[model samples]
Each structure stands twice: as structure tokens, then as C-alpha cells.
Target: MKTKFLLDPNITFLNHGSFGAVPREVFAVYQQWQRTLENQPVRLLGRKLPSELRAVKSALGSVLNANPENLLLISNVTFGLNLAARSLNLQSGDEILTTTHEYGACLNTLKYLAHKSGARLVQQPVSMPLKSPEDVIEEIWSGVSPKTRLLFLSHITSPTASRFPVAQLCRRANRAGILSIIDGAHAPGQLEIDLAEINADIYMGNCHKWMLSPRGAGFLYAGSAVQAILEPLVVSWGWNVDTPATPEMGLLENLQWTGTYDPSAFLSIPAAIDFQRKHNWINVHMSAQETLSRFLHRFSESFNIPIAYTPEADPYIQMAVLLLPPIKDPEKFQNQLWCKYAIEIPCIEWQEHQFLRVSYQVYNTEADLDRLFSAIEDLMPSFLTTSSHTKSGSL
Candidate 1:
């Protein structure tokens, strides 16, 4: 099938785990919303915007299995995490436990919060060559203590692309009386997400990443119990203390409308959902996952790379990270792949070994994987022989 959204045909785009490419149809809908807003800015923003956003949230909620009241549309997962971080009631000696394999931006957010609240951010280490979901949950929970107040985790990690057993961990957190915050940035489109089933106290996901919406589209799902505890990062008209607003009003006023900004991205959520349905995304995802597994198996064997996780244990979608040989200059080697071969994939340095993460979408094919394989085959020998060659080619 031909790709309907992405126009970048020249480059072998395997970086859907990063900022996702939007589908043309959904993007058209986004633009239409933008134009409508521009045509009647006053009516759109002041009168129709709230109702429009509520409908969008309802549509998204039905798919996510979330309460429409609890979910607020945000720009990105980072923004949602930032709101949570700022709202957390951390104190000295309170520990925020997390895995070592989290996204760097989320890690930084946790660090900033820790510094501000005098709370310790404890990073639990999970060794590679993951066997099962239970093993992951065990390794992560072993780090939690009586002082652990919060459990932060990624549903699907950015660097490693391994799917964590967040649902089970969230249950463990509940028993321990620790708050759970899950970064589900890559999980929404890649997996069948039932937020109620997962039951994290706070969960955030990006529609922009894998959901194929426009940039500046994401959601924060806070459980009804924890809604009152969260303070909005931006204090707008929503924080009117004199008005004695309802709980719903508090959420809309404080979090939903965060000053003046384009709501086109949020308004386009239904279109993104509809696009997936029209394309039969479930079948597409399963097919893509199988293709990715085969490619990973072949690529890893050819390059003498190690597999980070077993296929059966963490097979949620089309993202996988292969462990490569330890490179002296990973940054340089990463750049060489892009500069020489027009390959777009993430090369990460994690715990000494370098990792090459390949994210497959509907647009990717075996031909794309072949180009990446060819590029690696050509570059690996040169990188091992001459270190300086890499530096010269890299940006």
C-alpha cells in the first residue's frame, strides 16, 4: 500500500518513535480547523472552542478507555509530565522511583522536581536481555522503599523501545500506596491502551508521536481521586478563587485553556482517530510488528548485534532497539548513517553499549529496511578501522 501522509520518499524513515509523521488526510483536517479558527477567531475561541474540545476529548476517551473529565488535551507528553511534576507534593526524604531506561526529557523533569522539593529521585537499573514482563516488574519494584512516594515509568521507552509492564507495576504501586505516573507517549497508537485497565494515578500520552496527529497534540489522564491534588502549571482564568467553581470548572479553567494558543491540534484528534480506523490501524500495526521483528532478527545477526528484549515478552508494536558494539564515538557514528546513507534512525548510548532503535510505521517496507542494512554493512567496517573518518563526516 502506498503511504498517504509522508512525503519524505528520499530518506529511509525509520524514526516514527520520534516525532511521528502525520497522515495527509488528518493533516488536512487539522489545517481546516486552523482556517476556521482564523476566519472567526472571536467565536471560535470564546464561544465554540470549549464545546469543540470537549467533543474531541470524548472521542479520544472512548478509544483510550478513559474518563473524558480526567483527560486534558496538552501540547505533548513533556508538557503533561511538566504539569504533573509541578503539581506533585514532594518533601525531603520522599523518593521518586523510576527505571534507568526512561526518556531523557522525562528524566530531566523528574530531576528538576527532585531538586525543587528535596525529594530523592531513585533510578532503578534493569539489565538488558530481558526475559519477561515479570522480570522487569521485579527489577523495578525492588528499588521501591517505604520512603518511595511516586513511581514514574515509560509504557514504551524512547531509547530502548522496550515495552515495560506498566499495568502490573501500577497495581503494585497502588498496594504500596505510591503514586504512579506513566509516560505513554508511544503507547497510544502502538498498543491498545485501556487506561482504566492500566490504572495509573496519572498517565500522559502524545497524539502527535504515534497517533499521527499534528504537533502540539497530547493528553494527560489524571484519575478522579488525584484530580484535586493537581495544580495547573499555568494560572489562567481557571484559578478564580472568588467564583467557587465546580471540580470540572477547575480543570477546564486551570488546565484545559492554558492562555491563548492554537487549538487546531487538539481539535484534530477525531480526524487522527478516524484516519486510523479507515486505514484499519490494528491490522496495519500487527503486520508492521511482524515485519519489524523479521528485520531486527536479520539485521542483528548480520551485524553481530545483541537483542535487548525477547520478541514474545515485549511485542506491543513496531518499535525495537538493537544493541550494537560499543563505539568510541557514538555521536559521530550516528551522524555518518544519516550523512552517507540518508538513514533516519536513533542511535543511543545506554550503559556503555550503543543502541540503534528502528521504529516501523505503515509507510515502512522491506525495501526501507534493506537500505538501512546496506548502510550499516558499509559503515561498520570503516567505523572500526578509522575513528577519525566518523568525526569528519558527523555534524
Candidate 2:
């Protein structure tokens, strides 16, 4: 039996990693929230918003194992990271150490901060053909030094789709007195997240990606110790000369409601959580993982490509990146996949190698993989071949 969602069935949607597709039931609840707000905007935003927000935050906190006080809803991981990067106090000669496998936007965000703070942004090169997660930890940690003030890394890498050993890295950073900021854009619903156990200074995740929430739903978690250092991206009415009775309450008042935007997306988080729980999200995840592993085995064997990360190192989530032959232009190849084949996988160029990333969700099935497989098979001989056959040089 196949699952139903708001996605169009006509297209083979293999790009759930980019922007997740929300289920119809969950979206219906989201729309209902929107309708409720539209009915009486003044009442929803003024009279009842605070209580509603507290309820949503409490539910999200239960799932993340975080204090509702320390958590603040943001538009996305980018928004949260931007706030953290801007709020931190970095001195000149300080080094911001990170891996080269991080998402491009996040790298840019760090670069922007480094440039402003007069600190050097050092990217530690992590070679592929990785044996284990320990290799990743060692490679990334080797760059840390007395000059290193902060360590920023992705829980699951973007381009390579390899899951880094964030917990181990966080422990090492803590021991060395370095602040850790983790970009968990793909982690929340994809994996079991225990914020207390991981214990990073700041962690940001996207609900839209794996949590199957509405777009622009994300949260930033600040450890109690570091909460004082975090400044809202947009300074609004929340900033005050005197501290409020509750720091968490102050954070919600100041940071959560930034200049009157729609809170429906944020309100729908509980519904997304309930939808997944009622449907047994773990079973859905395991089923997707099994199918993805099978498809990956077949696809890699057919194309003579090796798996970039091991199952033990990076277990199957909603997404995985397969290393492919280096292409001259990865963006062009991605465009071809979309325009010619209607296949929506992401082709990323990382470490001079090309990667074809596929994302599987509850709405995806074996037939979807079969379609992608058939498309790649058709493209391999004529388009992906080494020799140029056409004048346009697409093949």
C-alpha cells in the first residue's frame, strides 16, 4: 500500500532532502490554523498567542529533550545560525574551525562572521573512502588549536550526505573549552534527537526538512549557559534594560515574536509530531531505510560507483549521497536530470567528485526508485559517457 501526500504523483520526487513534502492530514491542520488566525487576527495574535506558543513549545521540547524556555522558533536553520554567528564575540586571530563537507550556505554564514570579526575561517579537508566515524572526528579535530575559539559542524553533511560524529566532537570541544555549534538541518525527524545528551552550546534544526512540518518551521536551541550570549537576529521589543522574571519567558517574548509574522507554521509543529506518532514514524523510517539500502546497492553496482559512507558510519535516513564520476559541470548535469528526465535528485560537486543524492520519504515507494533507476540507466550510455557525442556536448 502506498502513502498519500500533497505532492503530485506525476513526478518522481526524489528530492525530499531539499524541501520535505508535508502530508495532507498535517497540512490540513496547518491550513486550519491559518483559517483560525484569519478569522480574528487580533484575538489570535494578542489574546491567545502566548498560551498557544507555550503549548507548541512544550510539545516540541518533549520531543527534542530540551527546555521549552531555551528553545525559540525561527524561520529556518539559516535564520538560527545567522543569529548565533552574529551574537558570538570573537576576537582577532581566533580561528573558526569546520569541515569542508558542510552546507555551502552555512559555510558562507561562517565566512561572513569571520570577515566581520577579523577571525580566520579554517576548513579542514576530510578525505573520502572513510573507514569509520572516528576517521571523521580525528580529521576535523586535528585542526583545533589554542587559537580555535569555536567549532561549527553539521550533524549530517549536506553535499556528501555523510553523518559526522557530532556527539564525540562536541565532547572533545567541551574538554578543550571550545564552543560548539551544530547545524542539524537534516537531523530532527530523520534521527532520534536528544538535545540534553548531545549537549552543544547551540544547535539548530529544520522542522520542514525531516519533521514534515510546514515550510519555514525551524528552531534554535541554546544551552542554558550560553543563552545569555545569544542576541535575536532582529532586535525587537523583547530587549529590555532589566531582565524579566523568567529568562525563558523573556526569550519567548523578545525572540519568538519578531515584529508580527504569521505563527501558524510554528503552531502546526505539534500536529506534525502527532501525525508522525500516530502513523509510527519509526516504522516508516525503517521501511524507507531498507528500500533505500537495496536501491543504493543496485545502483552503485550498476554504475561502478563505491559507497561514500558505511552503514555503521552513517545509517540510512531520508537522504543519502552516492559518489559518481566527476562531471565537468554539476549544475548543468542537475539541470539535465530535471529538464530531460524529470528526476529531481541533487547533483553536488564536492572534493572534486560528483554526487547524486536521493531522498526517500513515507510518500516514496519502490516504484519511485525504479523510475530513477530507469532514468539513470537511459542517461548513462548516451549522456554520461566519457566521449562527447553531441555538438552541445551534453553527453
Candidate 3:
């Protein structure tokens, strides 16, 4: 599986939750689309691009269990969320409620929108040793008020790598008449996504992360009810409500043609999906989960570091956040791990605690976890002992 990917073989990569590695075959398809567009730019852009986007949408919709007409292909999750944030009609004194576990970019987008609209952006706090879905629901729902016009949350958190119960949360918001906008950036490939079942008002995901598509591939999905409120982030030919050039152009078409850029990554999404399907991704996912669980147990026992969550209760399928012994400088520890050992992984600082997030993909193996363990074991003593003054001086 590792051999099929374009990732550098020399480096141990445990950060698939970040920018994903593209398979060789998928990259070939992506490049071929680019070449085809280059060969006949006018025809492809003018005659074929619309149909191509529609086909891609249908393919994605089938997998996502969403309506093709309601989906818009965007560059990444942040881009999609930006479109959503701008489209939302937030007003003075309204609150857009979210949790602290959200991705920073999305959080900033919300903050910017809140500032622009005079709406308050509230960050609901969630604690570690995370409890059940019901508990999380109650804690998060406590933040919701009559002023909460929007509910934004991550399906799988980036900082702590905890999977929130978005479906239940969405239901709560829907009952309260609050619009639900879920950031599923890490969920498309990491978990089973049946948007039909989840029923959020608006949802967005990144295909470039766990989905294994080329970079800059993501989609924004809006429910039929919310279509009218969606305004285009960039005004273009497809949508000019004042002029009304083509009244037929709906939300999907209006947002799809947001100027000319490389749509090759978007086109190759089906190839990435097909690659996962052919390989029996569920088994691969289970294998990786089991491997991760084993590694977490051993690492926890070896270092006497407490595990954040029980294995049975943890919802982080392939990615687990391992709490580390208190380190003086997390940034230095992360840099040293990558620079000294070529072990590429996420060392996160959340809630004033240090954690190492390990991501397991189809391309990863038990050997990769062993390498990480060995590297950290060798570096932990020095990392803990190194004086903050020394680190500050070096910096």
C-alpha cells in the first residue's frame, strides 16, 4: 500500500490527517486531466467543464449521500467554510456558537464574520477524558441560546483528534431553529458520511485530507431549505441577481464557476474514491485502528503517560491523540522530532497540555508506529531536561 503512494519512502509520515498523500494511480489521473485541459483549453473550459463538474458532483454526492444540485466543489475545507460564512445572514447581537476543538482557519473565519456583522462568536469549552456523546451534547448545547443563530462544529477535531457527535448536535440545533454548519474536514475519508442520516443544514469536507485526492479538493453541501440564503462568495457570470442573466442558474451552478482555476484535483476525486473502494478500505481502516490501539497501549505503559480516552469509548477512528509528559517547549520538541529523526507527525498543544497526534492511513504500517516510539523514547529525556532559557537563547 505504501509503495502505491507518491510519498517519500525515506520519511516516516504519520500525519495523514493533514494534507494527504496521493496514490500513484490517482496522481496519474490528476495529471492526465491537466494535460487534457492544456491540450484543448477552450473546448474543455467552455464545452466540457460544466459537464465534468456535474459528473464529479454526482460521484461525490453518491458517496456523501447528498443531492448533486446542492454540492459545490471548492479548493479546501477553509475555502468552503469561507463561502458558507459569507453567505450566512448574521446580524447584530446574534451568536455563532462553536467549540474550542475547531480548526484555527475556520475559527478565524467565524471571528471575522462575527466582527463584520456585530455578532458574537462564542467558544464552548469541552474537557479532556471526554465523556459519552450524550454528555458532550449537553455540555455543547448549554452554550446555545435564543441569540445563537448559527452552530458550527468539527465532525473530527484537529487539535485533540476527538470525534464530536455532530448528528445529535445538528438535531438539537434544528429543533432550536439554529442553522447547523458542520466542518467535516477530516470526516469524508476517516468516517462513514451519510449526509442524509446526519441532516445538517450545511456541511463541508476536504477531499485532500483523508480522502487521498490531490491538494485543493473539497466540497460544500447545503440543504434544499438553505439554498436561497446562500450568496456567492465571488460574484461571477453564473450569478448576478440584480441583472438576472440566467434565472435558471441555481446555487450549485452559481458557485461552481467562480473564475478559471485548475479543476483537475476536483476531477480526480472519483479516482481517489475508486482506489479506496477497490482496496477494501474498511478492512484497511480497521487494521490501522487496531494497530493504533496497540501502539497507544504500549506507548502509554512504556512512558507512564495517561491515555486521554478509553479505547472502547474513543471515537477517533484512525487518529489518536496521545498525551505526553509536560514539555517546556512543544514547538522545539516537534521541530526536533522532524528535523532529527525525519518522523513527520503532529505534536499539538491543546488546553495547556502537550499531545502527539498519530494518524494511520492505508499506506502506514506497524513499523511506522515503532519508528515514532523509538524516536520519541530517545528524545524525551533531552526534550524534558532542556532549559527554557537555552531554548529561548537558541531561538
Candidate 4:
């Protein structure tokens, strides 16, 4: 798997949740698409791109168990979220309900929407040591009110690495007449995605994160019922400004052609799907979590840190955020792992606590985890000393 990917072999990459690494085969297709686009710009962009992209969408639809007509190619999830936020046309006193465990960029997007429309953004806390899906559902549902116009949540939260019971919540939102949007940025390739099953009004996912596609590959899925209300972020061929909007125009006509950039990333999606299938990635994904679970136990005992919870839950399938002892400077500790040890993993400060969010991809080997553990052991003393001095108010 390591040889299959194009990541720097010198660095131990434990963070695939942040921009994903592209497989060599998929990258070859990406490069080929770029060359093809450059080879005959007019022929491809003007005539061939739409059909070719439709083929890609059809392929993606198969993977997601969705209709190609419902999906639109996007640069990333952030773009889709911003589009959803602004298009909904929230008014004064409207509330956008979400949990505190959501991604930061999405929180900002909702914040902007709230400020612009005089709406409210209620971040209900889901609390630590998550117990059960039913409990989590009731906890988040408490935030919904009469004025709750839209319900936005992550299918998988970025910071906490939690797989929310989105289907249950989306069903609740649907019954309540609240529009539901899911940011599934870290879902594809890592977990099974069935857009129909999730049943959200709008759903967005990034293929670049876990799907092994080239960076900048993502898709936005809007249910047929809600597609009518969506306003494209950029007005292009999508907008029939002078002419009346046509019923035949779906996501393809409304949001697909927003001034051409590079379609290579989007085009490479089929190849990425092929790569995972050829490698039997479902078993691989499951195996990764099993290995990480075993490693976490050892890591917890060796470091004398209490286990927060078992990552056997869907929320922690291939990725898990492990608890770490309080550090005076989490940034410096993270830098030491990167600058000194050449280990690429995220050390996060969330909710006044420090953490190590490890992403176990197919490329991560036993040696890579060993390298990370060794480096942490070497630097643990210094980190603890810094915490002691900082707490004592002495340098």
C-alpha cells in the first residue's frame, strides 16, 4: 500500500484526515486527464467534459447508492456547505441547530449565515465519553426549536472523529420540516456511503480525503425536493438569469459548469473507485481499525493515560482521537513530532484538552506506528516538564 501511494516515504504519515494522499494509479489518471484537457482544450471543455463528467457522476452514484442527476462535482466540502448556507435564505429569528462537535469551517459558515440574516446558531454540546446513538440523538435534538429552520451536522466530525447517527437525526429533521445538511468530508472510501439511506436534504462528501482520488475532488448531493431552492455560489451557465429556470435543469445544469478550472481531479474519481475495488478496501478499512485498537491499548498503558472510550464504534472506524496528558505547549509538542521526528499527525487542543488524532490508512504499517510511539516516549519527559513549569508560573 505504501508503494501504491505517492506520499513522501521519509515521513511517517498518521494523518490522512487532512488532505488525503493520492494513489499512484489514480494520480496517473489525473495526470492523463490534465494532459488530455491541455491537448484539446476546446474539444474537451466545450464538447466532451459534460458527458465525461456525467459518466464520472454515474460511477460515483453507484458507489454512493445515489442518482447521478442528484450529484454535482465540487472542489471541496467547504464550498458545498457555504453554498447550502447562503441558498437556504434564512430570515431573522431563524435558528441553525448543530452540535459542538462539528468542523470549525462549517461552524464559521453557519456563523456568517446567522450574522447576515439575523438568525441564530445554536451549538448544543454532546459531552465527552459518548454513550449510545439514541442518547446522542436526544442530546442533539434538544437544541431544535420552533424557529429552527435548518439542521446542519457532520456525518463524521473532523476534530472528534465521531460518526454521528445522521440517518436518525435526518429523519427527525425531516419530520420536523427542518432542512438537513450533512458534511461528510471524511466519509467516502473510509466508510460505506448510501445517500438514499442517510436521507438528508443536502449532503456533501470529499473524495480526496479517504477515497484515494487526487486532491480537489468532492461531490454535493441534493435531494430532488430541495434542489429547487439551491442558489449556486457563482452565477454562470447554471443561472438562467435572463431566461426562466427550466424544469429539465437539475444539478448538472444549475451548478456543474461554474467557469472551468481543472476537471482532472473530478475525472479521476472513477479510477479511484477502481483502485479501492481492486485492493478490496472494505476489509482493509476494517483491518486498519482493528490494528489501531490494539495499538491504542498499548499506547494507553505505556503512557499511563486512561482510555476515553473504545474506538470499536462506527465513529472511530479508521480514525480515532486518543487522549493525551496535559501539555504546556501542544503546538511545540506537535512541532517536535513533525520537525524533529518527521511524523505527520495532528496534535489538537479541543475543549481545553489535548489530543492525538491518528488516522490509520492502508498505507500505515506497523513500523510507522512503532516510529510514532518511540518519538512520543522520547519527548514525553520534556512535555511534562514544560507543563509543570507553566502551571507553577516559572519558566
Candidate 5:
């Protein structure tokens, strides 16, 4: 299974949560699409691209339990999120409610929108050691008011690595007439996503991250009611004033055709989906979970840092966030891990506590976790004791 990925065997790549490792088979398919596009650019882009994109969307929609008509393949989650954010016709005194644990890029998008619109950006602080899904919903909902026009949240948070209860929040927002936008960048492959069941007004996911697609693969899913509000971020072939709209050229036409660009990543989505299916990703996920649980247990005992969630109410599926002792410099420690040990992982300082967000893909094994544990054990003293020792000397 490890041979399937292109990641270097010498480096213990634990940061799958950051930017996913593409399977070699999937990368081959991605390259094939690129070559096919380059062979006859006009024929591929002008003639066959639309139909090919529809097929890709159909395959992706099948995995998400969403309608292809409601989906548009964007460059990435940030691009999709920007489309959703800029589409909202915000006004003064309105608010966009979100959690404090959102991905920084998406949060920045929301902040800019909020600032431009004179809408307040409320960061509802949901404390650590999360209790339950109901509790999460309640805490977020508490920030809502009559002026709350939109609810934005991550399906699986980037920094915290906690799975948010988006379905319940979406349902509540619907009832309250507040539009819901979910950044499901980490959800598509990490969890079973049924968009129909989730029923978010505007949902965007990154196929490149968890779904094992090539980079630049992601999409935005808008419900029928919200589609009218959305205009393409880049207006090119999608919205031509000269050409009249046809029945077939409906929502997809409006959002899909954003000028000529490399559609290889978009076209490779089906191949990636097929790859995951053929490999029986459910079992892979389970094995990863077991490994993560074991690693978390040992890491907690080793560092005296607690795990954020419990089994009965676990938010994460294949990822877990390890609460670390207050390191004087988290960025330095993270860099040292990469530079010294060739251990790639994300360490963040969120809400005054440091956390290591570990992602377990099929390629990772217990031995990988063992190596990480050993490295941390050996380096903890240096990271904690030498706060001002700027030199990258041996511990």
C-alpha cells in the first residue's frame, strides 16, 4: 500500500491533513488527462470539456450523494469558498456566524466579506474537550440573532481536526432562514458525505485533500434556491452577454465555464474516486483510526497532554489533534521536527494551546507513529528548555 503513493519513503509524511498525498495510480491518470488536453487543446477544451466535466461531476456527485446539476468544479476549496462568500449580498448590521476553529484562509475570506458588507464576524468560542454534537450546535447557535444572515463552519476543522456537527447546524440555519455555507475541505474522503442529507445551502469541498485527487481539484455545491444568488467569480465563457441562455445551459453553465484553464485536475476526479473504491477505503480508514487511537494514548501518557475528544463522542474519523504542553516556540519546534527528523506534521498554537494535528492515511502504519513518538520524546527537552537558542544545533 505504501508503494502506491509517490511520497518519499525516507520522510515520515504525517501531514496528509495539510495537502494530501496522491496515489501513484491516480497521479498517472492525472498526467494522462493533462497529456490528452495538450494533444489537441481546442478539441479537448472547446468540444469535449463540457461533457467530460459533466461525467466527472456525475462520478463525484455519486460519491457525495448530490446532484451533478447542483455542483461546479472549482480550482480548490478557497476558490469555491470565495465564490460563495462574494455571492452573498450582505448589508450593514448583519452578521456571519462561525466557530473560532475555522481554517485561516476561509476565515480571512469571511472577514473580508464581513468588513466590506459592514456585517459583523462573530467567532463563537466552543471550548476544548468538546462534550457532544448537541453542545456544539447550541454554542454556535447562541451567537445567532435576527441580524445573522449567514452561518459558516468547517465540516472538519483544519487546525483543531475536529469534525463539526454541520448537519444539525445546517438544519437549524434553514429553519431560521440563515444561509449555511460549509467548508468541507477535509470531509469528502475522510467521512461518508451525503450532501442530500446534510442539506447545506452552499457547501464546498476539496477533492485534492482527502479524496486523493490531484491538486487544484475541488467543487462548490449550491442548492436550487441559492443558485440564483451566485454569480461566477471570473466571468468569461460562462456569462456571455451576446449569447442567449439555453435550457441545458443552466446552473452548470453559469458556474462551470470560468474561461480556459487546465481541467486535468477536474477531469481526474473520477479516477481518484475509482481508486478509493477499488482499495476499500473504509477498512483503510478503520486501520488508520486504530493506529491513531493507540498513538494518542501513548502520546498522552508520554507528554501528559490530554486528547481532546472521547470515543463515544469522537469528532474526528481518520485524524486526531494532540494537545501539547506549552512550547515556548511552536513554529521552531515544528520546523525542527521537519528539518531534523524528516517528520512532516502540522503543529499549531490555537487559543493559547499547542496542538499537533496528525492525519493517518492508508500508507501510514503503527511504525510511523512509533517513529514520531520517539522523535518527540528525544526532542521535547530541547524544544522546552531552549526557547532563545536560535541556532539549529543538536539537542
Candidate 6:
């Protein structure tokens, strides 16, 4: 599996959550699109690209259970949320509710919009060691009030790697007349997603992260009910709003084309989707879970650092955040792992605490995680103040 990707074999890359490794076949397809576009730019971009994009959307739509007409191929989740946040006409005293675990960029988008509209962006803190998904639903919904006009949240939180109960939350938001916009950056390839079942007003996800595609491959989905409310980020040729002179042009016309831009990545959606289908991602997901579960158990047993996810609720899947023992300098610890161990993972700082995030994809194995465990054990003594860092094993 690792050979099928272009990632360096010298590095133990456990950070697929950051930017996904593209399959060789998908990369070939992406390159092919670029070459084909250059062959006849006008013939393809002006004439055939729209129809080709419709096919890509159709394939992706089937995977997401969303109408192809409702989806638009975008650059990334950040871009998609930006469009959604700015389009919502919030008034003074209106509030957008979210959680502390959301990706910072998405939160910034909401914050900027709220500030512009004289509205409030309420970031509700979710309790750690969650008891159940119901607890999550309650924690976020408790932030809602009559002032809450929208609920913006991550399907799978970036920092913590916890999958929120967005579907249930969306259902709840629907009852209260609050719009739901889900940042599904980590949801599409990691889990089985159904946009219709989730029923969010707007959803944005990246194919580049977990879907085994190149960078700049992402999409935004807006249900027909909220499509009319969206405003394009760039005022290009397709900025036709609902005017008497022109019929209401949907997202296809309004935000699809911005200018002369390279869309090879966007055109590679079908290849990415096909790669997953051909690989039996279901079995791959299960295998990754099994390996991740073992590593989580062994590391917790040896290091005495409790895993972030609640054991029973288990809101997490492959990606995990382990709160590290206090270190003099978090950057040094991370640097040592890369420089000495050749391990590629993220050392995160969230809420005044340092965390080590692990993201194992299909290419990873138990041996890979075992190497991580051994490296941490070998290096822990130098990083820790005391010689011990464990509950019963050592410290």
C-alpha cells in the first residue's frame, strides 16, 4: 500500500490527517487532466470543463448522498466555509454557536462574519472525557438560544480528532430554525457520510486530506433551501444574483467559475473516489482502527497518559490526540521525534496544553505504531523533568 503512494519510505508518516497522500493512479489522472487542459485550453475550459465537472460532481455526490446540483468543487474547507459564513445575513444580537474543538480557520471565518454583522460567535467548550454522543449534543446545543441563527461545527474536529454528533445536532438545529453548516474536512474519507441524512444547510469537505487526492481538491454542498442565500467570494463572470432581468442562477453559475484557473485537482475527484472503492476502504478502515486501538492501549499503559477519547463513547477513529506529559519545550520534543526517529506527526498546542496527534492511514501497521511507542519510551527520560512518566510502568 505504501508503494502505491509517493510518500517517502524513510519517514514513518502518521500524519495523514494533515494532507493526505495521493495514490499513484489518482496522481496520474491529475497530471493527465493538466496535460489535457493545456492541449486545447479554450476547447476544454470554455466548452467541455463544465460538463466534465458535472460528471465529477455526480460521482462525488453519490458518495456523499447529496444532489450534484447542490455541490460545487472548491479549493478547500476554509474557502467553502468562508463563502457560507459571509453569505448568511446575520443581524445584531444574532449568534453562531460552535465548540472549542473546531478548526481555527473555520472559527476565524465565523468570527469575522459575526463581527461584520454585529453578531456573536459563541464557542462552547465541550467537556473532556465525554460520556456519550448525547453529551456532545447537549454540550453544543446548550449554547444555543433565540439569538442563535446558525450552528457551525466540525464533523471531525481537527485538533482533538473527535467526531461530533453533527447529524443529531443538525436535526436539533432544524427544529429551532437555526441553520446548520458542517465543516466536514475530516469526515468524507474517514467515515460513511450521507448529506441528506445529516441534513445540514451547508457542508464543506476536502478531498485532498483523506480522500487520496491532490491539494486544492475540495467541495461545498448547500441544500436547495439555503442555495439562494449564498454569495460568491469572487465577483467573476457568474455573479448573477436573483434579479428580475435574470432568472435565479444556482451555485453552478454563481460560484463555479472565477477566472482562468487550473482545475486539474478538481477534475481528479473521480480517480480519488475510484481509488477508495477499488481498495476496499471498509476493510482498510477496520484494519486501521484495530491497529490504532492497540497503540492507544499500549501507550496509555506505558506512559500513563490517558487517551483523549472516552473509552465507552469512542468518538474518535484513526486520528488521536494524546495529552503529553509536561515538557520544558514542546517544539524540541517534536523536533527530536522527526530528527532522530524519522516519525512524522503533529505536536499540537491547544488550550494552553501540548498534545501529540497521531493520524494513521491505510499504509500504517501495528509495527509502525510500535515504533512510535518505543521511540517515545526511549526519548521520554530526556524530555521529562523526573525520570518517571508513567502510572505503573515508569515515569
Please list the C-alpha lDDT of all candidates, in the order they appear: 0.85, 0.83, 0.87, 0.87, 0.87, 0.85
What is the C-alpha lDDT profile of model 4 across 185-253, one tens digit per residue?
Answer: 999998889999999999999999999899889999999998878888988886886864555856445
**Colliding pairs, model 5:** none
Q: After superposition, which runs of candidate 6 have C-alpha atoms over 4 Å from their true positions?
A: 241-249, 385-395
> Every model's Cα RMSD, please?
3.7, 3.4, 3.7, 2.9, 3.9, 2.4
What does candidate 5 score on TM? Answer: 0.95
Listed in order, each prediction's TM-score against the native is 0.95, 0.94, 0.95, 0.96, 0.95, 0.95
Deviating ranges (above 4 Å) for candidate 2: 1-3, 242-249, 385-395
Q: For model 5, what is the error of residue 314's alpha carbon versus the real structure, in angstroms, after optimal superposition?
A: 1.0
Model 4 lowest lDDT segment of ten: 386-395
- Clash number by candidate, in order: 1, 0, 0, 1, 0, 4
Residue 177 of candidate 4: its Cα lDDT? 98
Ten contiguous residues minimizing lDDT sum, candidate 1: 386-395
Tell me the lDDT of candidate 3: 0.87
Report the C-alpha lDDT of model 3 over 197-220, residue by residue, as the tens digit: 889999999999998999999999
For candidate 1, list the clashing residue pairs, or say none. Answer: 238-253
**4 or 6, greater by TM-score:** 4
* Alpha carbon RMSD to native, model 2: 3.4
Candidate 4 residue spans exceeding 4 A from truth: 310-314, 385-395
Candidate 5 segments whose C-alpha is farther than 4 A from its true place? 241-248, 385-395
